[model samples]
Target: MGQDETVSNTALEPAVPQAEASRRRLTIEVVIVLGLSLGQSAVYSILRIIERMTRNVPLSQQTSTLNQSATPDRPWLDLTYQLVNIIFPLFAVLLVLYLLQLTHPRPWRMIGFDLRRPGFDAWFGLVIAAAIGVPGLGLYLGARALGFNTQVQAAALADNWWTVPVLILAAAENAILEEVIMIGYLYTRLRQLSWRWPMIILGSALIRGSYHLYQGFGGFVGNLIMGAVFGLVYLRWKRVAPLVVAHTLLDVVSFVGYTLVAPHVSWL
Candidate 1:
C-alpha cells in the first residue's frame, strides 16, 4: 500500500479511551488524585484532631470559621473581592473538566450531568436537600451541644450590599465543586479503574468525610452520611444535577439563614 493509504487507515482506527488505556492499580490512582485535592486537609486535620483528642481538649476549642466575607469601606473593592471569592472555585471545576476531557470525548455526559432535566433535577434535588438538610441541622446542633463537634459559625460576615449575594455564590461554588468532584468525577474515574459500586461509594464517602475533618469528628460523621447518601443517589439515578442542587440549597440556607435565625434560636 502507498504511504497515504496506510496513513488513512491508521487515522480511521478506533480511539482507545483513557479508561481502558491503562491497567494500573486503583490504589495508586486514588492516592495521587486525592493527595492533590482534599487529601491535604484530610491528613492534616485528622492528625490535628487526633492530637487534640489525646489531650482531652474541648470540641469548641477546635472550630472552623466559614463564610466570613469582609466588609470593606470601599464599595468597588468589596465588590471585586466578593466576585473573586465567589468565582474562584470554578477554576477547580474547570480543572476537573479539563482532566476528564483527556479521557472522555464528551466529559459532561460521561459525568452523568443532564442540563435538559433542570426541573427534574431541581425537584429531586429539593427532595434530597430536605432529606439531608433537616437531619443535618439536628446533627449539628446536637453535636455542638454534646461537644462532639465545634460550634460552626455558618455566617460571619456582617450584612453588606454584596454579603448575601456573595454567600449565595459561595454556596453555589461549593455545591458545584464538591458534587462534580465527588459524585461525578470520582464515580467516572473509579469506574474506569473497574472498581465495584459499593467499594467506589464507600471510598467516595470516606474522602468526603475526611475533607471535613477540620470541622471535628461530628463534621466527619455528618459529611460521611451525606457522601454515602449522595453516592447511593448517583448509583440509582445516574444523575448529578440533583446532588449539585441539593448541596447548593443546603449551603445557602445554612450560611444565610443561620444569621437571621441564630438570634431567635437560643441553641444555635
Candidate 2:
C-alpha cells in the first residue's frame, strides 16, 4: 500500500510543472496580443480621443469619414486595398485564436463557440438585434439632430457586382473581430488575471467604446452604452456567436440601408 501511494504521488507530480508552464505561456500570449493586435486599437483610440478633446473641434461640423478609397489613383490598387480592409480584421481574429490555442486547447468551445447551438444562437441574436436596432437608429438620428454627431455615410463604394458583397463581408469581419477579440479573448484573459466580473465587463465595454471615438462624442456615448449592454449580455449568455450575428445584422442595416436611402432622404 505504501509503494502504491508512492507511485500515485510520483505520477501526479509531472502535471504541476506542466500546468505552471501552460499558465506562463498564456500570460505571455495575452501580453503579446494586447500590444500587437485587437487590444492595441483602444490605446490608439484613447490618444485620439484626447487629441479630439484638446482640439475642441465642432464634431457636428466634422465628417467622420469611413470607407474612403483604398487607392484613389489606381483601380487595381484600390481593389486590392478594398479586399485587404476586410481581410485585416479577419487576420487579427485568426492571430488571436492561434495565440489562445497555445494554452486553451479548445479555445473556441471555451468562448461559447457551440456549433450544436446554431439555431438558438441565431434566434437569440435576432432578438438582441431587434432590441438594439430601433434604439440604435433613434440614438443616431437624435444625436445628429442635436448637432452632436456627424451625418455618417454608411457606404461610399461605387456600383459594382462586388460592392454589396464586399460591404456585407466587411460588416461580418467587424462583427467577428470585435466580438471574438474584444469580448471573448479580452474578457477571458482578464478573468484569468483574477479580475472581478464587473471590472472585466466595464473594462471590455470601455475599450469597445473607445475604439469608436472617431465618430464623435455621440459615437463615444452611444457605443459606450452599447458596450455595457453587450458586455452584460455576453456575460449572462456566454454565447459569442449570437453577439456576432447581432452585430452583423446591425451593420448590414446601417451600410446597405444608408446607401439605398441616403439619396432620397434629406434628413439623413
Candidate 3:
C-alpha cells in the first residue's frame, strides 16, 4: 500500500508544476492589466487637478492684472504632460509583463502582435475598414447637418509642417492606449468571467464613449458610434493592429479636417 501511494505522488509531480506555471502566468497578466489601468486613471485625475488650478489664472492683463501672467514655458509643459500621460501607462504594462517573464516570444505571437504573416486577412481588414468608414463618414455629415459643432479650435497649430508629425503621434498614442485597455485587457478579463460577446462589446462601447463625455454631446455620440464600430471590428478580426491603424486614420482625418475645413464651411 505504501509503495502504491508513493507511485501516485510521483505521477502528480509533473502536473503540479504545469498547474503552478499556468497560475503564475495568469496572475501576472491580471496584475499588469489592473496596475496599468489604475496608474493611468490616477495620473488623469492628477492632470485634471492641475488643469483646474491653472485655469484659475487669467490669461491677459485685462482680465485680472494680479492673476495675469504668461506661462512662458507652456509649450514644454504641455509636451511633458502629454508624454507622461501617454508613455507611463504603456511602460507600466510592459514592466510588469517583463518582470513576470510572460513576455516571451510565444506570448507575443499568441497575442497576434507578430507581423510576419501577410495573409488574406490583411486585405479583408482593409475591406472591413472601408465598409465601416463609409457609414462613419455619413454619420459625421449627418451630425454636421444637424448643426453640430464641427468647428476646430486648433487650426493655427497645423499651419506649421511640424504639427503633422505631432498629430500623427497623438493619434497613434490614442489608438494604442485605447485598444490595449479596451480590447486586449478588458475583453480577455470579461471572457474569463464567462461574459457573452454582446455584453462584452456593449460594455466596452459604453466605457469607451463615457471617457469622451467631457468633450460634449456631439463628441459623446461620435465616440460612441466610433466605439461600437471598433468593437465590432475587434470582434470580427481579433487582431488589434488593424483596429489601431483604422482608428489612427479616422482620428487623423477628423482632426486635420476639422482644423482646416470645418471653420471655412459656409453651412457649418
Candidate 4:
C-alpha cells in the first residue's frame, strides 16, 4: 500500500474499539456517580414507598416530613447537625465537577453553573418556579384528597434563630446538586454517547421521579413531569443555572413557606 493508504487504514482501524471504550467509560462513570448520590436516594425512596404501602394507615393519613430537627431538645447542637447535613451532600457535586474537568477544559461553563448571565437566569427561573410550584401544590392536594398521596410536611425543623437561613441554604444546595448532576452532567454525558433526546429526557425524568417516591404516587408523578420540563428547558437554553435558580426558589417556598403557613392554616 502507498504511505497515504497505510496511514488511513491505521487511523480507521481503531475507530470502532475507541468509540466502544469511550461509551463504556462514560457509562461506568455515570453509574458510579449516581450510585453514590441521587441513585442511593432513589433506592431508599423506593423502599420507603413500599414500606408506606404496607402500612395499616391510608397513604393520605401518613406523613413524610422534610428538614426535621436532628436534636430537638438541644438547639445549638441541632443547629450544628443541621448545617453538617446540609453541607456534606454537596461533596458529590464537587466530585462531578472534578470528573467533568478531566474531559472539558471549562466544565463549570460547559455545565452552565457559572454566573455569566444573571438577569436571564433569574427571570427565567422565577417563571419556571411559578409554573411548576403552583401546579405541584395542586397535584399534592388533589392526590391527598383522593387518598393516593401522603401528607408531606415540607418543613418540620424546630423554630430556631437559624431555621430560615438553614432552610434557604438547604434549598440552594438541593438546587445546585440536582440540576448539575441530573440535567447538566447526565444530559451532556448521554448526548456524548449518542443517545436521542427523547430517551435522555425520559431517563432523567424517571430518575427524578423515582427519588421522590417516598412522598407517594403524587410526588413521583409530579416530579416526573417537573423533570421532563426542566430537562426540556436545559436542552433549549443549554444552561443549568436557570434550572438551579428555579429549583431553589421552588424549594424555598415549599420549605420556608410551609413553616410560616402550616401553623396558621387548617389546610396545608
Candidate 5:
C-alpha cells in the first residue's frame, strides 16, 4: 500500500509542472494584453486632446463648416474632413497597437473581427437596438416636447453626393475603433481578472458612456443605453463583427433619416 501511494504521488508530480507552465503562459499573455491596452488608451487620450485643440472650433461650428465644404465642387475638403474626423483616429489606434507589438498580423483575429456569424443574435441585436432606440427616441421627443433644449440644430449636409460615402466610412471607423477598444481589449482583460460577466458588461458600458460626456446629456444617456446593449451582445457572442454591423446600421439609419429626411427633427 505504501509503494502504491509512492507511485501515485510520483505520477501527480508531472501534472503539477504542466499546470504551472500553463499558468505562467496565461499570466504572460495577460500581462502583454494589459500593457498594450493601457498604452493604446493613453495614446488615444492624448491624440484626442490634440485633435480637439487643432480643430480649434466648437462642434456646432465645425459641423456647419463641414456642411458648407461638402459641396460637389469641394469633394476634397469633404473627403479630408471624413479622413480627419473618422479615419485618422482609427488608424492612429491601430498604428499604436502595431507599434506596441500587440496586434496580430491577421488583423481580423487580432481585433476579434469576425463577420461569418451573423446568426439569430445579430438580428436579435437589431431588435434590441430598436427596442432601446424607440423608447429613447420617444424620450428625446418628450424632452423636446417638454421644452428641454436637447436638439442639435445642424443643417442637412446630405444633399452633397459625397456625404453618403463619408458618413459610411465614419460609421465603419466608429464600429472598428470603439469595439476594438471597449469590447475586444477591455472585456478580454476584465475577464482575466475573474470578473463576473455582469460586472464586466456594466463597467464597459459606464466607461463607454462616460466618454460621450461632451456630446450632451441626451447623447450621454443614449450612448449609455447603447453601450450596455452592445456590451451584453459582446458578452453573449464574444464576436465583434455583428455588433459592428449593428452599430453601423444604426448610425446609417440615424444619418439618413435624421439628417437627410428630417433635418429639423426636435431631437437628433
Candidate 6:
C-alpha cells in the first residue's frame, strides 16, 4: 500500500478498540442505572407474579394494590409516607438527567422533557392517552374476566384531604421516572451503542412488561404494548414530553378516578 494509506490505516487502528471499549462501558452503565431503578422493580415484580401464581386462589381472585397507605390509621404519618414514596423514586430520574447533561448541554430539551411546545405536547398527549387508555381498560377487564389478571387497585390510600393531591403527584412521578429513564435515557443509550430501532423498542417494552408483572399477565401484556407504542412515539418525534404527559394523565385517571368511583361501582 502507499505510505499515505498505510499511515491512515494506522491512525484509525486505535478508534476501533476505543469504540468497542466505549460500547462496553455504556453497556455497564445501562445495567447499573437500571439496576438502581426500574430494573430492580422488574425483578420484584417477577417474584410477585410467581407468588401470586402459587397462591390457592386464581390470579383473577387476587388483588394488586398501588398507593396503599403505610399507616392507614394515622392520617399524618400516612401522608408523610405517601409523599416519601412519590418523591424518593424520582432521584433516579435526576440521576439519569445528570448523566445526560454531562454529554448534552440541554439534556432535558434533548429528550423532549422541556416545555418548548406545551401545546403540541398536550395535544399529542391527549391523543395518545385516548388511544392507549380506552383499549387498555378493555384489555384489563377482559384479562380479569378470563382469569389472566389480578384485580388491580390503583389506589388504596385513605380518603384524606391530601389523597387526591398525593395521587396526582404520584402519577406525575411515575410518568417522569418511567418515560425519562425507559424511553429517553434507555433508548438514547442503546442507540448510541449502535442498537437497531426494533431491538431497542422491544427491549424497552420487555423491561416495562417485566416491571408491571406484579399486576399479573394482563398488566404485563398491557404495559408491553404501551412501551412499544411509547418507544415508537419517542423515535418518531425524538421527544418524551408527550409520553410523560400521557402517562401522567392515564395514571391520574386510574388512581384518582378509581378512588372516587370504585366505591359506587361494584365491578370496579
Model 2 per-residue lDDT tens digits across residues 1-268: 6755556556666555765776677678777876776558777877765665566666666566566666565766776888888887687788877767866998888888558689988999899889988998888788878876776777887666666777788788888988888888888887776779889888877777777776766777777787778888988988789989999998888887877888898876
lDDT of each: 0.80, 0.78, 0.55, 0.93, 0.59, 0.94
Q: Taking the tens digit of each residue's C-alpha lDDT, what string does model 4 give over 1-268? A: 7765555556666456777898999999999999999989999999999999999999999999999999989999999999899889999999999989988999999988999999999999999999999999999999989988999999988888999999999999999989999998999888998999999999999999999999999999999999999999988889999999999999999999999999999777
Write the residue-wise lDDT of candidate 5 on 58-131 in tens digits: 43332211122344466676667656777566764564345324424554554446555557537855776577
- Candidate with the larger TM-score of 1 and 3: 1
If scored against the real structure, what TM-score would every candidate get? 0.83, 0.84, 0.61, 0.93, 0.63, 0.93
Global lDDT for candidate 4? 0.93
Q: Kindly indicate the candidate among 3 and 4 with the higher TM-score.
A: 4
Candidate 1, after superposition: displacement of residue 256 in Å? Answer: 0.6
- Please write out the lDDT profile of model 3 over residues 1-268, one tens digit for every residue: 6855566556666555765676566656665565557435434534543443356432121110110112324655545554555576576445433533443444334434347544643565466567666676666456545544242232234244344555666666776677766766566656655679889788777667655433323444666777777777767767666766667676666556555675677532
Estimate the overall C-alpha local distance difference test score of candidate 3. 0.55
Task: State, as a TM-score between 0 and 1, how close model 2 is to the true structure.
Answer: 0.84
- The numbered model that scores best in lDDT is 6
At residue 260, candidate 5 shows an lDDT of: 66
Candidate 3: segments with Cα more than 4 A from true spot: 1-86, 92-105, 118-126, 140-159, 266-268
Residue 137 shift from truth in candidate 2, angstroms: 1.7
lDDT of 6 by residue, 73-107 (tens): 99999999888888899999999999888768888
Cα deviation of 82 in candidate 3 (Å)?
4.9
Clashing pairs in 3: none
